[model samples]
Target: MAALAWLLIPLFAAIGAGLWGSWANRNRKTAGDGIELAGYTRFREAMEKPDAVVEPEPHSGG
Candidate 1:
């Protein structure tokens, strides 16, 4: 009947939402932070270097 079909819509939606939530939350472990930390250290070292000297512009006569 039309009422039965309408009732099924939410039931199906709840099942689908539960399955999607489980799939979305299933965790996979990260390999390690060694590589990422090393890269971050290099980035910090590069950023700490002194700024390069800028040459003064020659005076221009008006």
Candidate 2:
């Protein structure tokens, strides 16, 4: 009986969370602008080699 009460805590929490999320998004509107308002500027590609060395000029065999 006590163990069942403890197990139902998470179930009740999930129900509450779902209700809150639904209510929060009930009257939401989409933004059509092409810009993001989060102001995040850092951008990086996946698995890009940052330590690569570049040769400014090619060696010519004389």
Candidate 3:
């Protein structure tokens, strides 16, 4: 019983720490917001452009 309690104490503490960190970081602003917004506008414009050819990259033989 004592051994099981010792194992579970650290496990529960780790879980609690992870949950706290995630909650703290939930409201932060990310760096790519402006880039994403610009990309969205460009995508909308591309939809209206007739000559846009979406090309798939040739896969390099990994």
Query: Candidate 2 on 1-62: residue-level lDDT in tens?
Result: 99999999999999999999999889767674434533323233323538667767876868
lDDT of 1 by residue, 31-53 (tens): 79999999999999989989777
What lDDT does model 3 reach?
0.92
lDDT of 3 by residue, 1-62 (tens): 99999999999999999999999889866696799999999999988889867898999989
Q: What is the lDDT of residue 56 in candidate 1?
A: 92
Candidate ranking under lDDT, highest first, comes to 1, 3, 2
TM-score per candidate, in order?
A: 0.59, 0.43, 0.43
Which one wins by lDDT: 2 or 3? 3
Can you tell me which runs of candidate 3 are displaced by over 4 Å?
28-62
Scored by Cα lDDT, where does model 2 land? 0.73
**Model 2: pairs clashing at backbone N, Cα or C within 3 Å:** none
What are the Cα lDDT values of the candidates?
A: 0.94, 0.73, 0.92
Candidate with maximal TM-score: 1
> Which candidate ranks first by lDDT, i.e. highest?
1
What are the per-model numbers of colliding residue pairs? 0, 0, 0
Candidate 1's TM-score: 0.59
Off by over 4 Å in 2: 28-62
